[model samples]
Target: MIQTILLKQRPTGRPKISDFEFITEESDLTLKKDEMLLETVYVSVDPYLRGRMSDAKSYVDPFKINKPIYSGSIAKVIASKHNKFNEGDYVSGMLDWKTKQISNGNGLIKVDATKAPLSAYLGVLGMTGLTAYLGLTEIGQPKTGETLVVSGAAGAVGSIVGQIGKILGLNVIGIAGTDEKVNMITSEFGFDHGINYNSSTNMNAAIKKVATSGVDIYFDNVGGPISDAVLFNINKFARMIICGAISVYNNTELPQSVSVQPFLIKNSALMQGFIISNFSEKFPEAINQLATWLADGKLTYTETIVEGFENIPKAFIDLFDGKNKGKMIVRI
Candidate 1:
């Protein structure tokens, strides 16, 4: 029997811990041929999980009532019926939020933890890292010395986007909600400039001051006024990669409109939305590239770890409220 978190119902406002409950279930532990038993380590709580709580049509199906939630998790094989893996082999992928899990060889991939921290496979070394890579490269098409602006810039994906922009020789600017996060992005993450949107009354002026040369690329994690502000400051033929809209993820009603459409029209700019699943076939290549950068000390990542399986729901809600630093993870 494993204690797992279950979504009791859909959220009404900010998701309360009451919407989820910890319960135990006897899972299939006895492995058949080519099967394995896994012990869970870390679970990811991303902004995308908020969309899964609603019935609205989007990139994926909503999280069903009374079912165990699934996300990126790091695990160790305890018992195996397959010859390819044995006891103590570490693996990572989408696994239900249970202390122990059963699986065949299909989705699980073995890893060597000696090369990097096991938890890295859940942050910069894994799916989240890949999202930043493909989303920025294929979609943003950033160029050297070009001005790049990124929203949610201190977060998991945003942090990677800005760092990669700097690595590619672009003048990077990050927009975050807190003075602490703004400082981290500019001083720690190497962003050429930083904007604290929460403290600024005029978002347009702040963006203009930071991106004085005008933005050539924008990686938008938050939509609404922040995005509207970025749109107005973009240069001609700029590209906007709409990776997420975390600001409105919890709203049950329609969101306010942005009055910045004229900028897009005047610039003849390109803006496209993406889901990591769209590039599923090339995930390995993305992961390999991210891992190389991480191990070679060319990249950096952060995790706002909320301890205990009981804290998963709170961790997710924190993302909507801009309370997390990088990737939010819960340890079971």
Candidate 2:
């Protein structure tokens, strides 16, 4: 039987495990021509998934109630009637939160386990990495010697953005929720400096202390107060890449925070918000560059893997708690 988790109820504030329900069904192993059966190997637990939990209008349609939640997953093709994918081929795609999945194999991409760990396709070498790449280069338009500050700096996209900034010879300052994350960003990811937002009483002052020259590029994954602080430190003509707003995703009411328009006008800066699919046309190019960087040892990544399929909901809820240091993945 295939077991799956379904969104049982819409959550208010931070999500709880009670908001999800588990069910089992007779395993659907039947495959028609051009169809494949996949066994989930790794399920991604990301901040963006939080927004999808609501019925609100967004870039992607909200997950329907009583249906299995879906996100990117790395799976092994256990059975296949498709010519493109043979049994034992590993693939990555937007799949359900079930142990077993049946697909027509339309969006699945074949992945090589030898080139990188199968799970890396769910993270660094996949959508997360592409988000950082296209967002930074295409939107932020970073240049050499500029100062870059990234919110949610210890997370999947922010960590990669900071590392890529370093590779581009920019000074990188990161903002994370914990001292541990702050330390990891500077020591492990080669960021220039990291601020512990949880410990700082005056975020603006703290950022000013380190970024004395003001920020030239801000890669923001967390919005709200942290973004307000970053906005106050922007240099003239600075660029802001608005990624995930993890801080306000769980809010039931309209989220309010310090305004950014004044700073945008005063500095003649640019702040652009984007969904990664905005650059879907160039994914092949982005993936090739990220894989090359990984092979060349010019880039590094991290994952906080939770074991077991049943714990998928817990893994996702932990994202709001800042429990993972990097990309959070459920290893089934």
Report every candidate's CA lDDT: 0.86, 0.92
Model 1 compared with the native: what TM-score? 0.95
Pairs that clash in candidate 1: none
Each candidate structure's TM-score, on Cα atoms with residue i matched to residue i, is 0.95, 0.98
Tens digits of lDDT, candidate 1, 133-191: 88889988877889989999999999988888888899999999999999999888899
Candidate 1's C-alpha runs over 4 A off are 56-59, 259-261
Report the number of clashing residue pairs per model: 0, 0
Q: Model 1 residue 289 lDDT?
A: 84
Best by lDDT: 2
* Candidate 2 local lDDT, 46-79, one digit each (tens): 9988888886566367887899999999999999
Clashing pairs in 2: none
RMSD of each: 1.6, 1.1
lDDT of 1: 0.86
